[model samples]
Target chain A: MKISAKEVQNVAELARLELDEALTAKLADQIGSILNYVDTLKKVDTTGVPPTNHALSLSNAFREDVVVPSPGTDKALANAPLKENGCFVVPKIVG
Target chain B: MTLYNLSIHDAAERLRKKEISSRELTLSVLERIAKTDTKVKAYITLNEDQALAQADQADQAISKGIARPLTGIPLSIKDLICTQGLLTTCASKILENFVPTYDATVIEKLKAQGAVILGKVNMDEFAMGSTTEHSGFKITANPWNLDHTPGGSSGGSAASVAADMCLGSLGSDTGGSIRQPASHCSVVGLKPTYGRVSRYGLVAFASSLDQIGPLTKNVKDCALMMNAIAGYDPKDSTSVNECVPDFTATLTQSIKGKKIGIPREYFSTEGIDPDVKNSIDQALDTLKSLGAQCVDISLPHTPYAVAAYYVIAPSEASSNLARFDGVKYGIRDMEQTELVDMYKKSRSRGFGLEVQRRIIIGTYALSSGYYDAYYKKASQVRTLIIRDFKAAFESCDILISPVSPSPASIIGQHSEDPLKMYLSDIFTISANMAGIPGLSVPCGFNQMGLPVGLHLMGRHFDEATLLNVAHCFESATDFHTKRPSL
Candidate 1:
């Protein structure tokens, strides 16, 4: 249950976060203590208990597929940090 | 009473009677904000000119005899809910300048009711922290005492209502965000049933746990706001199709013969401030005197609620926040050449320390080998917690407890320790975990003159019962009427 600095680094990488050594060490220690506290759940026997992902139990909400007016390209890209030619501009994915 | 300090119902009556104009009311509120918001820091963005224009429209509607309950009311909105063409920062640097092209379903509903929006208020960045100190913009102080926190992440909403900057406000609660701040600031806050209000425009936190509700000066005003906002919406699949009742119609109903459950675990929980306990005990006596029966009940899984919430909320947040990568919306890093590098750099630079910590914790919990030990186990515990509430509700009409273990803490008291801050939400988290309606009403003041909130929780979609009980308490007490000296 003790999270090491290296594991913190690995998790940050997986989470796409760039944490410096100090934050990584601090997070490892903090997350380790929190997990240790959360380990109390292990004491509660949850045998045969179905995990609840949501509080309300509802079936799949399906609606008929139909063409709906979109917000339009201009409105959709209004909040885009970088955009060009009615499209979102992003860094090159393929060299 | 000053026009700015009038409750929604009172102001509505005045506006309808032609005793006060909406423009006058809005001007009074704007003047109040201009005077006090510097010290309280409740608002992040003030909509002065727009509010005046809306007030004029409201006055026109009033003159035409078509005014609604909120027709001329000026209210602040928590920054997370999208406001069309308005700055909707979730109090984060990532979306500092993000403006929504469309209103959130709740915002649209409020606008349709002629509610004049004052502006977007500050909150914890991403609604992640219990205190507004984590806001990327600024920290909102508790109106009662400038040195203390207005319990968050709805701190700004509660403080604005308590400080008379606005008549009422809309706040989203993922855990105890709404109720806790309402408690600390001695205002009224209600977190409706998970599906009771549409979440279409709310910036996703923990999607399953997040809900939009109202914070107001009194319980009836809270009910009025609920009547305006709660209902089904085709836009949000999670919004329930249940009938939205007249939330204010049941406010005057007597609590006689109502079965109030006193959770034994909550009373015995460690670290509950003595002053808070004393206030709750006195409040219970008042309820008992009003002909209500207090029953002893057990929610044995109460201790594990904070633990389960940490895992589940963070896990959901990590996944939901993935959309913030440098491309579609929010800030992007232009210095990085590679796509992945830009994502990493932008996210790291955009997010605050607490956000990064949660993302890491969530990623680690959901990681391959740790999934069973963390996320699954937490989900199973959530089931147990839900079962506890279901059984407790069967025996009692409502559950009453302290909103928070203590009153608002001094600012920076828990800033150094994240776990300590998380534990402050212990009492309030279970209501969110169970997805039931929870309310906070001003019960009494602590020894330091800080307000203490009486927590009332009810069955699923049973906000009426909670409102009735809170209204009854307000009728019998003057706590809600005691304004903080700014």
Candidate 2:
């Protein structure tokens, strides 16, 4: 339950965040305390209890494959920070 | 009485009778906001021109005899709910200018009924924190005492109604966001059963727990808002296919012989302020005097709720917020040429400290080795919490408790202490974890005059009982009538 700064940095990296040393230390302490508190869940006997993924009991909701009108390319792309002809422009991935 | 202070029911009746014009009502509210919002900082954005234009259209509709129940009612929408052509910042800088192309389903329904949208109100950044202190903008002050914090992340919505800046407001409750603030501001806030109101356009925080509901001047207005916004929508897969009831129909029903459960665990929880306990006990006594049966109940798993919720909510939040990678929408770091670097730079800069911390915690919890220990264990505890509510409801028609362990804390009280702030939600989070309808109505004020809220929670999809019980108590007391002398 004791989250170290190294582990916090690793998790931050996995979460696609860049944390400085100060923030990493703070997060380690805070997250460590939070996790320590959450560790109380271990004391409860959840024997034979199924994990609840959702508040309500719901199943896979299916619909007909009928095509509906989209928001159209322009409106959909309105909030995009950068855009190409019609698609979102992001930093290139492939060489 | 000032036009701004008129309840939605009274305002609608007057509007229909042609006694008061929608423009007059809207202008009065706008003027009130202009006069008081500087001190309260309740609104993030005020739509003055558009609100006046809508009021004119509503007047035209009334003249044509096409006015609906909420025809000219001015509503302050929480910033988390998307409104087309309006900035829907989740009080975060990342979405400061990210106007949605479409309105949230609730907004669509309100617009169809000719509801006048006054503006978007402030909330915690991405609805994460309890106080509006976490907002990228200004901290929203509790209308009762400007120096005190309005319990949030729906602080602005609650403050607006308390200050008479708007008749009613819509707010999203993930974990006590609506109810806690409503309690602090001495307003009525209802968090309907999950999926009762469509979450199609609500900004995702914790999907399983987040529910949008109303913050209003009274119980009747809360019910009226429910009628406007509650229904199924195909756009949100989780939206239930159940029939939306006339939420106001049962308000007049008697609560005689109704079983009101007082959870022993809730009262026994550590750190419950003495004034809050006294106020809640007095409210229970009032219910008993109204010929209601008060029963003692135990939800043993109540203590584990906050811990479980933090894990489950943040874990889901990590996945939900992963969509905000600065590519499709929101801000992007243009300087980075590499995709990975761009993602890191954009997310690190785009998200606030609390958000980043949550992402890291969630990521760590859901990571390979820790999943079973943290995420899975917490989820199992969530099941136990839900079962506790199920058992408690079997013996009671409705459960009553304090909305928060304490009344509104002073500003900066929990600003530096994350764990302390998280504990403020202990009394309100279980209802969400159980997916039941929860309402917070102003019960009484503490010695300092900070309002205390009486929490009423009922079985899933049974908001009628909760509203009816709250309405009955509200009728018996004048707590809801007391206004901040702002």
Best by lDDT: 1
Q: Candidate 1's residue-wise lDDT over B11-122, tens digit each?
A: 9999999999999999999999999999999999988888899999999999999999999899999999999989998998988888899999999998998989999999
Quantify all predictions' global Cα lDDT against the true fold: 0.93, 0.93
User: Which docking category, incorrect, acceptable, medium or high, applies to candidate 1?
Assistant: high
DockQ values, each candidate: 0.86, 0.89
Candidate 1's displacement at residue B225, Å, is: 0.4
Candidate 2 DockQ vs. native: 0.89
lDDT of 2 by residue, B1-486 (tens): 479999999999999999999999999999999899999998999888999999999999999999998999999999999999998999988787798999999999999999999999998899998878889888999999999989899999999999999999999999999999999999999999998999989999999999999999999999999999999899999999998889999998989999999899888888889999999989999999989999999999988999999999899999999998888888888999999889999888888988888898899889999999889998899898888888888999999989999888889989778988898899899988989989999999999999999999999999999999999999999998888998
> B351, model 1: CA deviation in Å?
0.7
Q: Write down the RMSD of all candidates, one decimal each.
A: 0.8, 0.9
Q: Which stretches of candidate 2 lie over 4 Å from their true place?
A: none
